[model samples]
Target: MIDKILNIKELNYASSLNGDNLKQKIEDLFERPAISFFGNFTSQTEFAAYDKLSVISWYVPNFKRKSAYLKGEILKSGKGTLIKLNIRPNTMLSVASIVSVLVGIIILIAAGSSTRFLIVGSFFILVGILYYSFGIFSRNRLRTNFEKTLDLHKV
Candidate 1:
């Protein structure tokens, strides 16, 4: 429900690689870490199966939280393969930010005549906007990375 509102990006691509080959290629891009708790801060792709691909940036320590995951599905087509991709915002993060803003607004409404409440509530809204904006920016960056790595023409 929240994901539907958080600007999901979708695209179609024409890939020459078959399902198995495409899976292998995307698998090569995933982090092969040995005894690592926190995964790569940089964006990387992983395959849940031959038909599914996930792009993630885990534990990226920064002001802008990387909160978007690129999810994709591969289908075998007559020519080669078709890739359907979606950049989805993190559900947990989105819900938390929205709830935080809502709580702030509720506080302001309850304290009808308080200027302090107004300031605090406005700050919450501002923070929520900033956080969501970073997620949007990260979405674009992830899209670019996926397109480049796949090297597929848009269909």
Candidate 2:
């Protein structure tokens, strides 16, 4: 699958809780639909984006949207419940950003020798790099939060 090839961020945890208890813990960690910044989930395992605004790290979400959505799978094992989590990026958002940057570059090329177009194109390239860099930088933070919330021990 693409997930395996892309090296998506995955966390596997062995929880002592039974299936229902594990599910409940995950459910409890999510904010109410009205309070959530992202869409509500009806799936058995998927949760909302990591949108808990913290005074200590208030700006994390802005750059994090590219890679903060949560997807998970719960499997019953003989020893315990297994929680498989994927910290997936917002695909649509990522694609849109790329498309926009490409458009900006194209416009700059079409504008020929204009200094203004060059400046704007450079800004677009800088913004794109910053956006991707910050997303990658925050992925570990999101993983840590999931571990703390679920009391996960890495497997």
Candidate 3:
């Protein structure tokens, strides 16, 4: 039992090293504001197929934190990527809304007298509205978080 535990611990350490190395490489390649870390944490009681799996999950936060630092460095270096990550969700929401609107129009034309078609169309409209609203909310949240981070660093 003790041997098994030791092996698991070693595996976890090795897995963490791999993640750290990968993050370091990304930082080196991006060279500043182009990177941001993302982390995931699990309850202590959670068990995975292997120790390595658990380590990767735990290491995500560290990677994200480092990425945030990288972002700052890039901002200071003035060599950061022009691309922004937060816009994708909004773009996706817009596309989905357009598609939903088109589908609703098609259903209205095809159904003629069927109430079910109306119901379906309304459902799609509702979904599209919710998607757009959620996207806006997400954008606001990201902005708020970024502001908070900047404030913290300022102090």
Model 1 lDDT, residue 96, Cα: 60
Cα-based lDDT for every prediction: 0.61, 0.62, 0.36
Candidate number with greatest lDDT: 2
* Candidate 1 lDDT tens digits, 44-88: 233321112222345555432335566677778798888777775
Q: Candidate 1: misplaced stretches above 4 Å?
A: 31-66
Candidate 2 vs candidate 3: the lDDT winner is 2
lDDT by residue (1-155, candidate 2, tens digit) is 65532335777889999988877866666644543223334576555555343213334544543345666778898898888877754453344446657867886887799998888887776666555554454555567767776678877
Sorted on TM-score, best first, the list reads 1, 2, 3
Residue 115 accuracy (lDDT) in model 1: 90
* TM-score of candidate 1 against the unseen true structure: 0.66
lDDT of 3 by residue, 1-155 (tens): 53221111111111112333433433343333432323221222121110111112344443321111111111111332211121112344445666777787788778788999988877877776775665455444443443343222221
On the 0 to 100 scale, the lDDT of residue 69 in model 3 is: 12
